[model samples]
Target: MADLITAGRAMSRRHLLAVGGALPLLGACARAGLGGGFPAQTVRVSAPFAMPDIAVPDFRGARPFPITTYGASPDDQARTSAAIRMAIAAAHDAGGGMVVVPQGVWPTGPIHLASNVNLHLERGATLLFSDDPHDYLPAVQTSWEGIECFNYSPLVYAFGCDNVAITGPGALVSKLDGWKPWYARPKPHMDALIALYTMARQGVPVAERQMAVGQNNLRPHFIQFNRCTRVLVEDVTIHGSPFWTLHPLLCRDVVIRRIKVRAHGHNNDGVDPEMSQNVLIEDCEFDQGDDAISVKSGRDMDAWRLATPARNIVVRNCRILNGHQLMAVGSELSGGIENVFVDNCHFIGDGKGADGWAVPIDNLLFVKTNERRGGHVRNIHMTNVTATRLRGSVLAVETDVLYQWRTLLPTYVRRLTPIDGLHVANVRVAEAKSVCTIRGEREQPVRNVSLRNVTVEQLSGPAITTDNVEGFRRDG
Candidate 1:
């Protein structure tokens, strides 16, 4: 609103909204019965779990450091990348600043952010990333699916930094020439994944679990804020990511608002907030190849070792153009996920995209887990969600969602994820295959699930289906 960052001093959340001009044309927050909560000036969540106020990062007294002064040009990728790195370093050294990318088509490689730096892009700017995987060489610590490994660096990466942001009305476009071939899961890729999983299972040091060498085609994330605090990503458009679009891993007090993502690549989820706390994702639009917002903790032995569950996350006022699910909570969650609230979101129907191809969504809220994924999912709530059409059920919970890893490897430890306390209210679906489906395990049945005022106009199957579910209820 206030240009994302004002000139002289840092602005509070209230100040940012107060001085705001006209908001974007994305649909307004859904205000149906028992709904209409948005996250414009604050994170106000009405859920069964306790939610603390998520603090938005304020860059007070931040100076401006333009990359052009450091010899960045629109043409040279090496020089622009170096200039960005230098500008971020200079700004971090100067305590805080806006590392500005002016209006131009700037080609760059990996952008590593530092503390107290707001990588601001002007309205006409486009930071086009190189497709070459080698540009992201010299491996940095990142995650593949859910296991931690030293792989290619994300397009924009930050680690252990506080008060960091990437803002403005610009676009981050990735050239996918290099990543297209690696999307195929060949034998080599499968072998590499097994190796990484074995290493993580054996408690190898994260520094030594490198997968950047050889034919290990573990794709890097587009933007990752790893182990950072007070992070904000706002008002930016992301296109054509290699993997998951925006990932906040083990972070605290993160706010991702007003960002648009149209990444239709393999496994290109919109935002994967894994093992993070106090997160608020609002007013965003996602046209993804995978789930729109997939909330996860960690996976298997790696997650058990970290011992940090994802908690107190809220998503509101977002629009999903196309996705496998409007929202998914973890088949990769071994460290538990709880206190999640999704409110006032809408899903656009099947439609032709900019490329003139039809994209369709599947489910509304899908909670997926497996036998090997030993975690706990509880206190989940969804309200005021309206979808025109869905290929699957409105609410689907599966205890056997291990996609490929099921046949590839045996379960080293037999543990079932316990799911409980799921409530869906004020959901209206125009057409769907079923109203709801819950397939819980016999060992640990899903418990305490309720549906109130949820209606589907045209449904092919039963209104409610359950297997090994306990304490299930339906209300008008």
Candidate 2:
């Protein structure tokens, strides 16, 4: 046991050192020139675009101020919040320095970010948020289950900012006080919570939610950037989010790289990009309770008003440790989505514990469309994806019904909506318990769906099954 512990410690140290060394290299690569007929106009932010020999840029150089203040006692809510506010102010006054969260157990309330600011944390640094409901007050604009509504403030939020980044080699932990146990709270409080959710569901504006910020009534997300541009988030470890870990909404030219996002909570997706364009996500690791990566758009009429499809997005060279769904595209796709490409990913499903056997994880890829509010999904490509253990179908596509009832509604609105132009290739599943399932409505059946070079080791049912498909083909 001692030897094993020693080996583990050594491995941890080595991993830390390797990560540290790569930072400089990555910085240098970010500035290097890509010469292979790559479009000069296009901005390449992936690791492959980094220069071969140059050192990574020191992030501190890009900042203007130093983190000289520390949050008060871990439990002192007011003091910690004041300190963080001061640090942000100092950084902003200095015309842009990083607000460094030095190595410590600083407990604080929600920390708001400013423009031209970088939230940097060094190794051994930890920013633990308070679990007290009152620490986070007032509802804010957020999404739940892909529906846009008023929710809690994200732990870190920035709206309509330019040249903002949250980069470091540290951890961002959200201490969600045991909201998981509904029984612990009083019945009246639970009823009120349900009422608030119902109001939001009815499309009541978030502004009407009289709840305090960061309260138990509405859950908070880890990192949220809304309608921002030129955003970069890299080299961070985030865990224990009450909701989605990293969510970018209505943003453009964003890059998320080398991030480790892990959380075990209801709807705690690893990364969700909603109503955003020109996104690049690469070299990230996700172990979450929900979908590893989900693409979504607006919901209902509000989504139509947004009218911006998530386009020109690419996700590559990532790993999914354990998630409800490895990759998913929405049931709330009101704004429509297109031009998505996912490549070179590995999914390692959770193994069965005890019982001397293993149960399967969910599907590797899931795509669905809502029936009531019609939308279009097209030009999606997946290549070189490997799944180790899959309990559900390798791929599942289900169109939403027009109404809540399983039965058809009065109008044609609840009819099956069509999804067009999906392509999957080079997909390999080592072990799967069920055949892939695809369902489309009768009228608007899925159109032009193609699968090539797809193989499954073990399948309990038909390898591929589709209902009401318009033009489906499999190229063995």
Candidate 3:
């Protein structure tokens, strides 16, 4: 296969399988040069990142400061927020140590983690977060959506800290009975959005762009790491979130692995890595209401002002049970995104009934942008994935998904998102509406898309649909 995939080798969809399947050919093409369905231009495919090797801290030599010792008891139904806070402080005070939550159901309020602290929950432990918004009072500096604002605090938050960790086999659940009602984009929410848009456009200082003091009523993220470094989250199961579940915003050197999240509320993405770099997400299971994993920077003028791109990220060995899209790249990617690799992942429906593949995935990979967002997305690679029961297209790239923002807010800049250098290889789906759909604006056409060895057993629509694209090829 390597010998056959020389430079300028042409292979069709059927020819790909006739030559003993396409994995070898796809891989060979990547190594030798653009072959099969790749574009004529030289596209640089990136390898997995090696720098920023973040590792979980070993607290073996350190002492464990149990929350129970800090006035927490499972026998009482009252909130254990204060006790947990005290325990975390004690652990940080003693150099670095583990703040332990013993095996029990502890209903708690917001938990603000400090630097050099490992918040570990023992087996059978459950931290049920309060629903009342007041529990997350004195809102910290957190972003809502992709715009910066001070709203309600995240359920578990770490701001301007380093070397933080959240690990356990237990569950951190959000009592969404209170936040579920806030999902509606009410007048207040839209008003806040307009205010934030105006502020970011007018170059208002982020410190003064405050929404916490008003009735703006924007929901907070579940777990957010803001401006922190060397973060790790592992082996925890999170259930039900008010907004994006695990958001590592403006952080560096992060590793999230072996975690499970099932958050089906509105905008409840499993992981939203926004404006962060050198991150790795592997062996995670996501059943989300929005995109399973949405890579974002900031939005519009806000992102332009921040001037940080989400880069050097890898997502592999993950399972996508349900979501709007398996992996989505913005409508909020105004700060640009680059060098992303998603490999060796599994996509299935909700694991229910007899075979555990009953649910259907809407789309596998979706890239969305609009005229208001002027970002550049480049060098994306995905390979070696198998899925069943795909109700929508296998791939979609749309550039006009403004939702209500098309009219709600004026386009501060008429710039369009430039998408280029995307590659996918060796993927198979049992059923899908179409192989792919590309809808690029006339002003900014999607460019340099390559697909190799992708097959759908049944397609309900045309094999490919496109409005405007350049250098798009699909082979095998």
Candidate 4:
């Protein structure tokens, strides 16, 4: 089951704030070109809000700083973790360059990037990360599930940088063999999470929320580009992830294209763009155990304090091989979300693993919030999409998803959120347990929902379900 936050009195958001490709277009061994190739002329991205054409830098004119030249060996030296840092410095010193990881297996700890650096992996090269949590110590600023904290650093992290990228045709594998021994959530994690919740409400400073200081054991994301600009991640095959595979937080002008992600471990969401805007994701393939794509802003009081709503995101030409949901918004959207457009996508469920066992997907589009969420969501549009199979409704909007918070804590009053202007059109679902479920809170009902040219070929349940929804319409 998908778990959302227990709504507390969260802060309200005022504002918030990126690919490519092809040569046959396998980015596996390719490197050195930037501005994504998929624009209005190529991918035929809709101009509903006039999604801007992404600019990928041309690295041909930049310097090349190969890690191997800086004493990084494919052998044990790669694990030393200092050689790659030197290379990133060399690139930054050159005013921007390609920090090349040549063909070989280079083991390392967390990779902290600088502005104008492109970490390019060559084919047959695998950048394997260690499973030890302490390797990412001396916590940098990162969020765990949405709350701001100084926690574990993401494996590939860029903080407050501009014009950074991770590109190549190689595989960036996380050796979770050590960490997986400790399952997704243990007692320590639960206790730590509860502590975070308490501290968030107490108005504790984020730096003081030192989650990485103790046995908190909160996992870090595989890739995080926080407070960045002009970010690009293309053509890499990211197989094993520590947490969310790719997360861009509080960023702008981001582009992700032609990447392949098959990280099925716990909380292995393919990509999460939180408190970000002007982003584009295209030509990517995902096989995850969680939502393929989740757009979020923030969680709880920390989020309310930020008040930066996520907006102007474009997701297209992506294929979901299997996951919990094709796309989802909130449980964490207290800061709010707007102007989202998803089109020309495919949700082909095939979660069956090596032994041929799997979990089925639930919905194509899921918008969820809880009573404690005081934010608003509007201007959501999904067009020209396809879903092969689903165990639940094709589209669902729920105002209450307290999950663990239902029994863990008590709420004084429902700070119901106002949801409106959901437009889904030209959708085809092969099998759906239910066509749609428009659930709204009694205090603030959902409004202005339009589903047109939608056909559920094999709907086993109700065609439409509504609760406190006004101006709901379905057209042929």
Best model number under TM-score: 1
Least well predicted 10-residue stretch by lDDT in candidate 3: 34-43
Q: What is the C-alpha local distance difference test score of each model?
A: 0.84, 0.66, 0.78, 0.78
TM-score of 2: 0.79
Error of 4 at 426 (Å): 1.1
276-309 in candidate 2: lDDT tens per residue?
8888889999877778999888655557656888
Instruction: Give the poorly placed runs of model 1, Cα more than 4 Å off.
Output: 1-48
| Residue-by-residue lDDT tens digits, candidate 3, 233-281 | 9899999999999999988778888999988888889999998988889
Q: Return whichever of 2 and 4 wins on TM-score.
A: 4
Candidate 1 lDDT, 3-91, residue by residue in tens:
21121012233333532321110001111211111111344555557888776556545689999989899989999998997888787
Off by over 4 Å in 4: 1-45, 50-56, 77-80, 350-357, 412-414
Q: Whose lDDT is higher: candidate 1's or candidate 3's?
A: 1
Cα RMSD of predicted structure 1: 11.8
Off by over 4 Å in 2: 1-42, 45-60, 70-77, 182-206, 209-216, 353-360, 401-416
* Ten contiguous residues minimizing lDDT sum, candidate 2: 48-57
List TM-score per model, in order: 0.90, 0.79, 0.86, 0.88
Give the better candidate number (1 or 2) by lDDT: 1
- Considering only N, C-alpha and C atoms within 3 Å, which residue pairs clash in candidate 3? 13-476
